[model samples]
Target chain A: MKKESISRIMSGIDDEYIKEAAAPVKKSGNIRRYITVAACIAVVIIAGIILSQADIISPSHFSSEGTTANESGGGDKKFPETATEGTAEAPLDSFITPGEEIDTELAIESVTRPKWEDMIIPMRYGEITLGEITYSSQCTEISSENILSKLGEAKMQGYDIYTDTYYTVTGEAYSVKSISTECAVAVRIDNGEEYFIYVNSWYEPEDLGDFISDLDLKNTVLFRKAFIDEYKHSDTASEHSQRVYADFDDKVIWDMLEDCLSAENTEYNHPYDRIGIETDMPLLGYKNISFCITPDGYIITNILNTQKCFFVGEQKFREFDEYLKNNVPYKEYNTVYELNPDGTIPGKGEDGQSTPGFNPDAPVQISPPYDPSQEEAMSNTQQSSSPEIPQDFIIEETTRTE
Target chain B: MDDSKIITLFFERSQNAVNELSEKYGRLCLQISVNILKNISDSEECVNDAYLALWNNIPPEVPDDLKTYLIKVVRNISLKRYHANTAVKRNSFYDAALSELEEVLTADVSSENEVLFKELSEKINTFLGGLSRENRTFFVCRYYYGDSIKAIAEKTGNTPHLVSVRLMRTREKLKEYLRKEELI
Candidate 1:
């Protein structure tokens, strides 16, 4: 009501007061001023020069030889400076654009967090008993058995979820400190006390030593510690330990990404390993792990918002099957060929070293998961002294173009 | 012509009274109209209509300040049009001004609070009268003229931040004044 009233005030009339004699209106006569002779002469001269140039200019100068009049960049000679907008059904009749740079759009539906009663279940880690081990959100709610089933299905589908263990030693930089939102849950016991139930050192086996200490969960560190300790030594630990190197600071990782993007502006070191983010696709502030690559080989690894892993050895980290296993939203068609001038991906290669040109045939040729990879890697490769282009990719691209 | 001459023309029922008013306040009325309406042709028509409205109301109305009366008339006319058209196509400039005030002054438009709008308007006018000349002009430029902060700064020759701060302080003062008036 106040807003409407105040707005009314902005529009309302002021009350009439007893008047003093009003001031009479001033000049009604038009006072015509002449243009200065010098100004007239200058205008005439400028107009003459403009008019003369219009006739002198050639049609060849206004060519659309190298410009993208439309986003398609179809190389149409008759391209207008303005966008060539048409119906969606309009086929590529005139121009053929270079490279596939289309991003798929999929609507994301948000749901409220799942009910605690349905989510609660008994679980044991070492001697510590858990009231519930699963975090049930509208998007993600899976029991341990469900998770195993998912991994098993992925394996049956030839997702290479297990063979990725081979490249675990080739690690770069990753945040082992954080756990996936799927693994984040609550532990409500029979004592009627609800304590914190978080991800133990399960993700980063290397950080298992201080995982319990880092949690500081309700002064029950000893109890959590015993449980974490047992998980660290279990068969899962031996199996997944090689992949999880624990130096990731969830708090400081974004700062690292900023540094990797704009390194010279600040004093922060550029991690040779790139954090390939969906510059366009921001899923609930979760930097949906697209894919990061070194220079030589490519791999589409894990897509956990919490775990940012390093593509240790190969530049083309080809673990797309692993990416498919995680039910995160991302478009498969939106790919770019990113070649860092420094020879390696942001954190994957050595510091500021000269890297080779893009190999269209190599795994790196295919692993650009998002748009920023083109921007970050292209900027890096553009400045580098040693930029190599493989003969095969050039021939292949040319053949396709023809 | 002087104020006495214009008032005399109004009293004598002369057609020159309308012409004189146009020469003196046509631009000013158009400015007030355009501030809210954001349409040139519509604003021009509104100003012309204000002159006609003035001609009809003058002998009985007997305004002390011609400038204020004209401003008030044009603002009211423009706002009527604004209310009518805002649902169809929103004027960002006028909407921005209203939203800025909306942050501090809120009435849910409930049946109980319907009259509160008019009361609040009266209180705001009283509050404006209490402010300094500079502060009053600053407040009016934003809420009345519906000018952008950058525009107010440019015209006032103050920095945009300074103009914004002054407007903020004035709104704060208005808030306190309204609270004391029990209109909040």
Candidate 2:
């Protein structure tokens, strides 16, 4: 057979294999929540950054590389064409026009803490610190119908299982799989009563850190980390869970977030399609934002409870994983599993009654002493619920043009 | 819109099915075309043609996965265009994938060998079935989808070098398997 026929022959492979190849691996519940919530924050910040950094488009870029829709046969136009040229030192707002600058700030500030009553906690990451429940209800819309309309022309509609929400998806859903093509998907969710829209795009996705850095929310933002591990009972072989909670230094969190956001799109398609319920629970956590650098090299955040996910490439995933493994300090709580395997220290059962699984005579596993402070913080913190959408984040057509 | 809804529209003879299908999968279809044709105008035209083909075919034939079906059609159309343009134009990405297969199945065959094509396809499927999930995904993504090594690496969360090495090994295995089956 001719070599060219091989392509055709390969197409007849089992449909199951094809489907398996196309679908991304399912993520765990906590990470899924992080992606959903954090996606909303990413949407607001990205849209705001796009507006503030609009001036990153130096006139020189327009003169040299700019092509109009008509010129490019109506192909997609990439935004912030000149953002790469901006140095880390230059704040993103520096690019804005004075009139537009004030307007953009007003839009952003409207979403900050305590202003709107239906305050949406865009991200509450960990159980340890309950990281600052940064509040915003600026993007919420009353009519479910209006939410779908805001997405421009939705080419497709999908359901997000985690939020129990339906979405109108605009843009190329498949481009998330391609590395060369710039991907942009505007996902609008209507939870039957209230709705919010977020645009998830990878236009120089690597610049997310720069955008976050520009906002300089690091100092004000609180981050919490949770390390969860599963241990096997030495005597009974029954598995139990252990959690270690710690706070991330704001700078470290910010730096890690930047590194993750700055990661180039690695042509991975982890299906930020409508968020789905993730069941496998991993033990590690980055911030109360429920941020997880998934093993498959994607960063997920449930900050806005949107369950939005994006690819951060493998290198970034490894770096984040390594940082969590080596640098972060954890005070383990619920250390009964670490004691003797000879049934001396009784294992806790589902009913909270001690099961006979511990062995005092067997080799003992040691863990760091439990810190009362971690438990105290967990008790003192009141977990925030999912927030309503921010109000002004919906970009006007003119805003994008400007 | 979901594939089932789109298919229902197609079954009902609604023109909106084409719009919904194009809206949802058009960008990806266009990307597939662009990868092979290497011309935006040509790619656009090829994708439009594929859409028309999809519209015509869906009523008579229901697809289990519209996205995959549409992609196969798009790739076929683009490959046809690529072959037609081979005299003057070259697409390194598409050619590289084709060349790898060419190296493995270098023996030329005529019309008489057409009967063996089905058996060869089945043998290949059996070979793929024996592979681990990761290796199977890597093979399909590379040879079947015509994805570049870098693209596969990014998608699979592996370095390009690792993807390339794995694909080479897989291809070697395929050659050996085919030889054992006496199909090549």
Best-fitting candidate, scored by DockQ: 2
Q: Report backbone clashes per prediction.
A: 37, 43
Candidate 2: misplaced stretches above 4 Å?
A24-402
Per-residue lDDT, model 2, residue A275, is 13
DockQ for every prediction shown:
0.11, 0.18
lDDT of 1 by residue, A111-193 (tens): 22222222232221111212222222112212232121111000000011111111101101111122322233332222223
Docking band of candidate 2:
incorrect
lDDT of 1 at A158: 8
| Model 2, position B51: C-alpha lDDT score | 85
Candidate lDDT scores, in order, read 0.41, 0.50
- iRMS values for every prediction: 14.8, 8.0
In model 1, how large is the Cα lDDT of residue A144?
30
